[model samples]
Target chain A: MPTGSVQHFLHGSISSNDTLQALLHLLRGLCEDAARGSIPFLDQEISYTIQLATGNSSMSLRARRSLMYEGYPWLLTYYGHTDSADSSRLVAVRTCVQAGTSDELPKFLSCIGFKKDFELVSKGHVFKKGDMRVIISKFYNPVKDPTHPDGYQPLANEYLVEMSAVSPKFCEVLAREMHTFAEQLKPLVYFEKFIPESL
Target chain B: MVVVMLISWESPEGMSPGHANEKLQKKIEILGGKILGKWDVDCEVYSSLNGIVGLSDTQTTQPANLGGATAPQQAIYVLHNSNYSLSTFAILEDNTVLIADSSFDQFMPHMKVFYKKGQRSDAKGNRYELNEFIIKTGVATFGGSQQKILLLEITYLLSDYVHESIGIIRELAKLLLDNSFPGIETPITVREDKKFSPSDLLLQYKALFSHVKKPSTVK
Candidate 1:
């Protein structure tokens, strides 16, 4: 759940210039491929949307051993800001795939952000100010919780505390682990990179 | 009772579990079959890149089964007959896949139901079927996001050492049985998308069937 604030830009220190270049590189290549096949991949731009306070206060707990993150689904967040007090400067990088492939990219992007690359076996946590917060573990699926006290409900609802001030810390850790992660993120900065030669 | 089975699925990060599970649960729905529950655990890594999902023998003296293995934590095991284990199943990314714990397999093997290849059958039909003495270890990362496992669209086979179905499913026959586990009349039928329904579970178990099938993909 994102705060829906522009603070996302200021928090993660994400760069729009670099990410945009990369996305252009990728989109251009995709277009070329589509053209070769006589299939125009219209709507080649990335899309952004926010999961605001929908009043969907649902949550599930992961095993202490298997918990991949602490604060989660309930809490929405914005990533990397252009400046502190980011009034309205945050970006969400998402590429469209055929309906069949839309579900695939989420996992791939997560793998790109985290270093371990392993599906989070452990739902980790970080306690701050005596309040337990979501730990930053990448590739973790928050939906696998079967032991919901609510007794078997939707896999969605990750009962996590929403916090922007500290949540960015998780992103920073992710960025630190992957020097180019911030650049590689599918955000404004990532959109700028030139697609690799392979394209 | 561990189900000692595997579940595989497609991935979409941050996609709400409710959303994905709703989709998959509807897909799992049956004439009467339903999802009882689901759980997520770490994905298991096997030496084989294929989705075989077998663990290497940690010890040599004992069987390849995790409990029997007697080596350091780093040990690997050989695969037993993977047949009779689910035979057919699905994995959706971030979905709550309720895998029976090892405890469930003991009772499940004795569980039997009627099923057919092309037509719906009754309890008295010739297509009577049931999973062998099976157990689940726990929810595992089955057919996971490729980045985590690094191997997808590869070959896989059930282990032979599973011991429950080994005798009945001779190499050739077993392969035939599991591989051909009847694909539900429809793959996208909804089972337990929103909540676990007991009737759905009983109906599915009773309706599901396994057959003589050997997996050629494992090697």
Candidate 2:
């Protein structure tokens, strides 16, 4: 895994289901090759967050487990602190690394002293244009059978809209391009690169 | 795959590491083992400022928002082996082993005040193939201390069960090291009804490394 790679992203939220549908429709029209299609993806992951027993600093251990994929290999992603991009960049920059892990990851983590924090499910559609990826997902509490639509509780009434591009070198141009693409979503949704004050 | 790790505690009455390696290589080659390639295993010691809370402690604690101070610093050995699928093994102080994807290194810097205290790498490790088995030998440079320890790791490719293959591994290790390998007998207690796991191999490594770190008794 290359340690120099970074993720440049912007976040926005759709207030309601109706607004989410409107925003999705708007994106379908705005995205390249609208008539082609979009890939629907379901993300069922359990995030094990371990905090230093003495401080507020913490790290999250998350692996993606999707029922749609055969055998459901756990593709682990280790996330570093999400740095708030400066005013000039207008995108949040975070360092993340992805690696292939086995199903014993949870048990292994427990042995090494990490406690399970929470598990959430996210289902949404993904749109891509060149190097850009736009994801619109809604969060839900874990369900017994993720393949089934019922027996799940929604964590939020809003849809999270994220636009991101991963690059090994510092990419100010890519961030600018993402900002311009986000601007096209206009009145339907407004994306910002702010990290909350509480974080 | 199952792995058994052993350390050559003494190199036949004052032989240097290089001389010992040459002797072992000749022995392995004479046994009809073919040199496969070179391997590298880097071990790093990292101590967490606010260490991860133990699971048992969390279960037994009172149900209050317990003050987070007074946690002991946790030290662990992180091993990266070139042969595995980028597997990163963490051997905690308590002999608890955790295996994670190699990319887990990216998250280490984010964990509260986690920093590397010492590091050692065996870049000249050798991988050899014998009939129905694989062998890896390396010399670990004890971090900052400049001490060298001989490492021998054996894998039984034909059998997945450790219990079924323990006798073969022990015999092979003894023959290759000329009976100077003391760690050979340590892994026997773990050979039971359970199948071999990579973590078990890592625990053996921790024991070997710590043994080399012990202070001398002569005053």
Candidate 3:
């Protein structure tokens, strides 16, 4: 694959079913000229935060393994902060590999010697609008698998909505356009950038 | 596991460009560095906006709040090298570098392409197979209408130890370029260390970029 474009993302949340429907309607109208497709699958992602044993120092590594209904069985992703803590913006370099089996997860982690700090599971529906991708995902606590009859509880009632594109240069322009599209869905699904503590 | 040292060069002593190219090639032949092939290494730099955290290739601990969450001291960059081997250089704020086989295009949905440069060269020697000196001469192009810099990169693939090979590479460089190599006294040597990161490489490239972008004195 040609791996050289910088991706930009704007994230928000959709809390109500009515807002989702309205947002979808507005997306269809805006993406009419762009190639559109539905990712008719419940994509699951398990993100493993890896940390070096350095006390409470806030720099560590992260790995994410994802599986889609129609996609490959195991897609492993690893990334981390390449710069220092004082940079104005956060930039990370990430690489993805296809693991033949699920058993390779532990082996991969051990080889890198990064301790698993935390894990989060998310499942979502994806929509591709031209080069832009819109994902609405529901985060869940992985420790409580609903199938295992444990305390399975949704992380939150709101669905995380993300609008992303592959080009860094055009991100601001695209973000502006996305903001306009998101404004139409105001009060329904407000899309903005998510700021995690690590960032 | 190959160690590389990149040295930039320019024509010496009022020598014409054509004559300088011929002289470089002749010197390589004399040193038994056979012509291996040619390479066109292209790279594009992507950075995040001020105070915005973009995609990360690895997990990170939350940075301590330095006073207030204001502008940072260093800027992070994802450098995409589009040579035969595709690679991404993630330069962190603290000079931490993370290199990966995959590109940053997939992760950063919003990135800015600050600069683009293509280094086209005639590569010589099979450092991997023959364990000899690998040399390359190329022209690096930064954005502007007329900005191209000559680059000469020499690699010693025989040993993983950069310190051991530096003396030999320096001797060879002195003979071939006749001290025309820029930064010959302190060539950019990339050695393998736990802390050695892509940021080091980016710093070198940034120097080249600034040097090339400077107003030309030749005109």
TM-score of each: 0.17, 0.77, 0.45
Candidate 3, residue A27: Cα displacement in angstroms equals 35
Model 2: lDDT equals 0.68
Give per-residue lDDT, candidate 2, residue B36.
97
Question: Candidate 3 overall Cα lDDT vs. reference?
Answer: 0.49
Q: Given candidate 2, what's the lDDT at residue B203? A: 65
Which parts of model 1 have CA positions greater than 4 angstroms off? Answer: A1-89, A92-199, B1-48, B51-54, B57-219
For candidate 3, the per-residue lDDT at B47 reads: 26
The residue ranges of model 2 lying beyond 4 angstroms of the native Cα positions read A1-4, A15-36, A44-64, A67-85, A97-119, A143-149, B2-7, B50-73, B94-96, B112-116, B119-124, B181-183, B186-191, B214-219
Model 1's CAPRI class? Answer: incorrect
C-alpha lDDT (0 to 100) for residue A189 of candidate 3: 69
lDDT string for model 1 (A163-187, tens) is 1222312344322323333344335
lDDT of candidate 2 over A22-65, digit per residue (tens): 87787787777799666787778777766666865666777677
- DockQ (Cα-based) for each candidate: 0.01, 0.37, 0.04
Best by lDDT: 2
Interface RMSD for each candidate model?
21.0, 4.3, 11.3
Give every collision pair in model 2: none
Rank all candidate structures by their TM-score, best first, as comma-separated numbers: 2, 3, 1
Please report how far candidate 2 places residue A96 from its true position, in Å: 3.7
Q: TM-score, chain A, per candidate?
A: 0.18, 0.86, 0.64
